[model samples]
Target: MLEIVLMHPDGKLQRLEAPVGVSLMQVATGAGVRSIVAECGGSAMCATCHVYVDPAWAGKLAPPLANELEMLECTSSERRPTSRLSCQIKLRADLDGLTVQLPESQQ
Candidate 1:
């Protein structure tokens, strides 16, 4: 299993363990992390699962694909350099302990 951290705007932290091959959105939604609405599920068709990857770990992830980048533009919160759609981030062993921040809102 891989460990991932989700930091909420209020400074609360949610730690989750998930197997490889699933998207971050799956882990978050499955774990009941309120910030990851995932309106389109894990299809990368919506920005409700948007997250700001911890800058320290951002470089560890692959660059967002074209579709993900386009969907990111529709996020309700301000987009940042580390902004990403959790649905697009596939879990891997190398990503254990990865951390991301939830925005103030998803609507």
Candidate 2:
């Protein structure tokens, strides 16, 4: 299992375990992390699963593909340099202990 850390807008933190080959959105939604709406179901069509990758870990992740970059423009929250669509982040051994901050809203 891979571990992920989520920092909520309210300052609460949640640590979740995810199996390899699953997206961050899948782990959050399955764990009832309300901040990750994931309306597009990992298709990267909706930006509801937006999250802010911890700057320290940003370099470890793959750059967002063109499609994901396009969808990011539709996010309900302010997009930052480290912003990412959780559905596009696949879990892997090297990604264990990854940290992300949930946007204030997903709607």
Candidate 3:
């Protein structure tokens, strides 16, 4: 299982244990975390699942692909160097302690 820590802007933190290989958006939605809209499921077609990857684990995951990059450009929130689309991030055993911060808004 991969353990993920998701933090909300209001200082709330949620810890979830998800099986490896699923997308981060899937795990967050399954846990009832509403920050990520995941409008297109895991298709990488929407940026509603945007999150900021913790700098500590940024290098552990794959760089964004062209599709994901394009989608992220549509997010309503300001993008940061660590910004990423949760749907494009797949969980792995090596990402057991992955941490991501939910953006202020997805509307």
Candidate 4:
């Protein structure tokens, strides 16, 4: 299991314990994390599951694919160097302590 720390826009953090191979969206949505709407589920079709990976853990994740990169343009938050679609982030042992900050809105 990996501990994924989700930082809400209001500054609260929800420490989630999830198994490897599941996408971040499924985990967050299943956990009922308020910030992640997951409008397109884990399909990478919507950017509602956007999050900013903690700089400390950012490089550990794979780069976004073309589809995810295209969807990011529609996110409510400005896509920063750390911006990533949660749907594309698969949990793994290497990401045991991953931390992501939710955007102010996912509309």
Candidate 5:
């Protein structure tokens, strides 16, 4: 399993864990974390699952795909260099302990 940490805008931190091969969105939604919206599920068709990957872990991830880059512009928060769609990130052993910051909203 991989442990991922989510830091909310309000300063609340949620530590979550999931088996390898699942998306962070799946874990967050399943854990009943109130921040993620994930309206299109994991289809990459929506940007509601947007997150800001920690700079320390950002370089560890492969860059986002073209469609994910486009969808990210639709997020309810300002897009940053580390911004990523949670559904586009599949959990992996190497990504254990990854940290992300939730936006103030995910509309």
Candidate 6:
């Protein structure tokens, strides 16, 4: 299992242990993390699963694919250097302690 830490805008945090190979959206949504909406499931068609990758764990993840980058451009929130679509992040052993900050809004 891989551990993911999700931080809310108000500073609340949710720690989830998800099986490897699952998308971040799947774990977060299943855990009822209010930060993720996952409106399009894991299709990368919507920005509702947007999250800011913690700089400390940024290098641990793979670069975003073309489709994920395209979808992030449509997010209502400003995209930061750490911005990523949760649907595009898959859990892996190397990402055991992955940490992500929830965006202010997922509209």
Q: What TM-score do all the candidates reach, one by one?
A: 0.97, 0.97, 0.97, 0.96, 0.97, 0.95
Predict model 5's lDDT versus the native.
0.92
What lDDT would each prediction earn against the true structure?
0.94, 0.93, 0.92, 0.91, 0.92, 0.91
10 residues in a row with least lDDT, candidate 3: 68-77
Which has the higher TM-score value, candidate number 1 or candidate number 6?
1
Which 10 consecutive residues of model 4 have the lowest summed lDDT? 33-42
lDDT of model 4 at residue 33?
86
Badly placed stretches (over 4 Å) of model 5 are: none
lDDT of 5 by residue, 70-99 (tens): 998899999999999999998889999999
> Residue 67 deviation, candidate 2, in Å?
0.3
Q: Which model, 5 or 6, shows the larger TM-score?
A: 5
Question: Relative to the unseen true structure, what is the C-alpha lDDT of residue 23 in candidate 3, on a scale of 0 to 100?
Answer: 94
Evaluate residue 93 in candidate 5 and report its C-alpha lDDT on the 0 to 100 scale.
Answer: 97
Instruction: Tell me the tens digit of each residue's lDDT in model 6 across 5-105.
Output: 98999998888899999999999999888778999889999999999999998888999999999998998778999999999998898998899999999
* TM accuracy, model 5: 0.97
Where does candidate 2 stray beyond 4 Å?
none
- Give per-residue CA lDDT, model 1, range 1-107, as digits (tens): 98999899999988999999999999999988888999987888989999999999999998999999999999999999999999999998999999999999998
Please give the lDDT score for candidate 3: 0.92
Write candidate 2's Cα lDDT for 1-107 as tens digits. 98899999998989998899989999999999888998878899989999999999999998999999999999999999999999999888999999999999989
